[model samples]
Target chain A: MESSQNQFSEWLNKQIHSSNSGAFALSPELRATSLSVLDAGVFPNRKNEEWRYTPLREILSQSPVLADKTQINPALIAAFKEAVPNALHLVFVDGEFSNEFSGSISALDKTGLTIEHISTLHGESRKRAEDTIRQSSLSDDNIFQHISLGLSRSGLFIEIQKNHEVDRIVHILHLSTKSESRNFSNPVHVVRVSENSHMQLLEQYASIDAGKALSVPAVYIEVADGAGLDHFKIGLESNQSDHVSNTVVQVASSGVYKSHQYLLGSRLTRANLEVIFSGAGAQASLRGIYLGNADQHLDIRTFMDHAFPHCSSDQHFRGIMNDQSRGVFNGMVLVRRDAQKTDALQSNKNLLLSREARVDTKPQLEIYADDVKCAHGATVGELDKDALFYLQSRGIEKAEAKLMLTRAFAAEITQEIEIETLRSYVQDRISNLLDGVHASNV
Target chain B: MLSIKNLQVSVEDKPILRGLNLEVNPGEIHAIMGPNGSGKSTLAHVLAGREGYRIDGGSAYYKGINLLELAPEIRAREGMFLAFQYPIEIPGVNNTSFLKKALNEIRKHRGEEELDAIDFLDLIKKQMKLVEMKEDLLKRPVNQGFSGGEKKRNEILQMAVLNPLLAILDETDSGLDIDALRIVAGGVNKLRTKDNAFVVITHYQRLLDYIVPDFVHVLSNGQIIKSGNKDLALELEERGYDWLLDKAETRD
Candidate 1:
């Protein structure tokens, strides 16, 4: 395992040194930080309690080449256009932004909203981007973040001006095309919602074909005082793909931050979400749904930190595993000594559809302050036998009954989505996936 | 329309119904009254083909078909309806959609055309009136957060819509208030036809006064000890089950 880590480090170093100079150049500070992290060799293994359920041995052993700039297929573009026609889409192929496939954003630009690529920033704008990244980088122990910073320079930088509300949704589509052997791509994104502004953003990761690839993405968001942001991250990659993502959010006083994540496909996927309440009276709601089948392994870890007084945070995550799939959920809530009147709650529920399916859930609440309300719960069980019988006794066949119960379980989360089109889109995708499973069973 | 001979059932190796026997012809309502733990619910569940029960012996025939040989869903499609004593609450399954699906499945089995959305709405609206159910309850989840009376009324509403050939009401009037009981009984009476039968299982005879059963039977230790007209229900209600148990023990 040590040898494999060394090989990965050496290969990453070589890629950084041999790549084109200007496009992938990193600032001195970021370079130093990345190098120090690489030298620490803190790559997660089964020994790490945070990564005990999901092992990265297979991903680390493979020497994945850095994906080259490739034109996305027109057919794939057409498919996305049909999926979300009204939204403004920004397409990223092989980790680089595509101009031809993106929608026109002139209407949004006139209203003081800036949506541009990070690599295109110059002068003070570039410095501001770097500063945002520096402030949001809470930890340097994450190897994936280091990799994303050191080698990949393609990402989005979105900023909403004060007192402006962006009604249109901004969708960032990350598409990976087929390549020889397994390839790797990393894209970083930064979003800053100014004071008294509101915005909605969606980041979707997908692949064009059934190709072997590994994607590591990083997202940083800051909700300023009295601002609100609704964010969604969707994972719909191929079955042969492996993905790891990190999302960090900071909410100021009186600001509201809401996030919904849907992880529906991939061979092995891991998502780490961290939200920090840095100011009093800030609120955050985090919800996610993950579905796994066959031999897939899915993991979700969340950290909700309450550093100020009179803050509240709630998180609810649900998982459905079938076949030989495995799911893991770890949620931790921390309240500081000065953070009184803090309200935090976390719940994780999992349903195993098959005998071989397994789930591991852990909920931790660490409170150092008095007069705070904190509670958490975790449950793992099979589908309710009585509910199934009720449906069956109503004349529904066994298979159809199972499907209805599964849909009902998922509706608890999907119904929370405020956007109607997106909710229906997700519902359609889930229905298709379950239909495929039924067909295979038959 | 239904006949059972010496039906014996055990749950978890413990016998609940030792030797229950009954016969019901079309166009008749048979009220089976018993004390608590006398196998009233066990008989209803076994007839509905619920699993987890070991059918020790005996047979049940519905319309000359072996009812025990069918799956729970098949039995339902074949016109067997069981109004649960404790209705299960499904959190996310909408009441209207659940009823629509069940109605369509039964229709498909009976060689009838399935109702479209508009027609289904029309039909359900009429049936909902029979049970005095609110229109909003149809939009909510099935039995979720419903009151005891509301759940019982929902069961009768389902029965009215399905119009089954054989309906088994297991303590349908247990938790209902006087008004709810009257509405539920009225709904059941409206659905009763000359070609269908109903088996009302209850511990009290108050429900029989509204539905007016054609026959009443006393179930003691999983066997019918006496069978007579509706006055028999009045006698049992007046004297309770102790007198009947004493008479059966004396005879044995």
Candidate 2:
């Protein structure tokens, strides 16, 4: 299985670098790079620094599910419809787009953002798409990008025109149900927030048993002077899949970027979040809450760079690990030489309920300039025994007290989410997860 | 309804309470007055069943039940209360809710009906006035951010609400001003009853001047060297525990 996955990764890298038809064409160089990374990914010891805590060796041991060429997953689709019925939904089944399960295609143009699929990018409109891909770095160093550019044609893309804000949310649903599939998928969202424009994006990932799902989903946000964007990623993937999700966010002069992630499921799910403060006075907030249980291995690596002066960034993430599950939170904050007075703070706190449950948190700060207010800290432990006794002494049953305190710990991060409905929904999900584990100290 | 027979306690292989015997019938107020390090507070803690205090060679009886065998909460539910000299400061649990839990625990154990929220609030309001504690403090976390006098008053409120048969006030008068001390003493004084007893563990005779113990026992070096009436405390106050200690040492 290891050697097979290696070959597939190598093939993927070759395909990515293969310079092809047009500007939208998959270059050989991109494919070769992805292939090499996946090839090297064969050894559990060689998984990238981001995958250090959550082992991918077990994930690679499973045979890859052949790609599905059929219908979208009804169960996966039903999950979202039950929760977010009003939002527009685009279906991607086994790394292939499905127009049959989609809703309201006209809403994209009407909402002032251009939406397109990767599979059908071979016509006159392909000229515009090709120009953008080559100019942008979405395909850089990513294997999913190579295959997504090569064989896939139905990926989703959204572009917000200059100086306009969308009032509705864009939901991209990835539903897969079959196995042994060549799994190279990319869900790209190009959001151009013109000067003073605003936009909010909701990205959801879900699937059924199939080849390990590699999502090179890239969200390119160009916030012009004075504009703002709020991006939320909700990962409710199937229980039997491996996923790698990348989000590249760029902020311009005086812009604001608020990003949030919720890692709910998947055998092995790793998220690479890169946010750059490209302009002076720009601000960003990256908040995440990962709840893991059983054999789940989830890692979220956040790289935030303060490239200009007077930019501010805050990253506060916490995790709850139960049973034999493992969780990792790696946060890096960098202040460039010229980024003076760049106020930045990062904190990662975790709660391990079971003896086997574990969390490895590393918070790093690299400040090139002095006179900056930058502080980073990480804590991994169970609930306070004294605090627990205090609650138990109050007649609160042991079980109920654990749940309340556990919820209270995560409340600090989830409360700051900009979307009211999203916040409440995530809170409910967290409560249910705690209730299931029976370790959530209320 | 509390009795102690030959209660001796030690820490780090050294005795603190050596062969001390005392008993307080219901409706009576007894004071244990001594200088610093008299093991006055240790006696209160041992009675309350705090962790890590070696009983050495004695047994305490509360309501005819072996008090030492029960855990702190179980003892608490069985009508045994201790007003700690230093009440614990819990940062998140609210004071009102904490007292309510204690009340219900004892009530439930005694086969009595539990107080509902409204009844509980009413009960708390009545007891708060005894210690002059404002409603705001009850709303805050247990003993957290409370002044020293306020913490002492909170302990009394717990005593009043729990209504334990044996209420041991350990150094209750240590950090209070005149006004605060009176409020605290008044609170304890109101709870005096034929079915409940008060053990006022104090350092000076001044608090006894207000609470007015029926019996004063001087504890020095793990032993009760002197036991007398209210006049004994006045004499010790005028002289000091050191003078009494010196007299006892020379005789030994």
* Alpha carbon lDDT of each predicted model: 0.85, 0.73
Error of model 1, residue A139, in angstroms:
5.9
Q: Candidate 2: DockQ?
A: 0.18
Model 1, B84-129: lDDT tens per residue? 9999999879999999999999999999999999999999999999
* Residue A215 of model 1, lDDT score: 85
lDDT tens string, model 1, A1-442? 4686566667776766664757763465666777667666568777778788887876776677767777666876777544455777998876777888887543137777887777666666667667777777543247888877766668878888899998778889888778885668788788889999999888888888765668888888889999999998788888878989888899999899999998988889999888988799999999998888898888898989898999999999999888888899988898999899999999999988888889999999999999999999999997788888888888999888888888888888888888888888777777777776655654
**Share of true Cα-Cα contacts across chains kept by each model:** 0.70, 0.09
- Scored on chain A only, each candidate's TM-score is 0.95, 0.84
Model 2: reference contacts kept, as a fraction: 0.09
Give candidate 2 misplaced runs (Cα > 4 Å).
Answer: A1-50, A66-155, A159-186, A192-194, A197-202, A205-216, A236-239, A397-403, A418-421, A439-442, B1-57, B60-241, B244-252
Chain A only, candidate 1, TM-score: 0.95
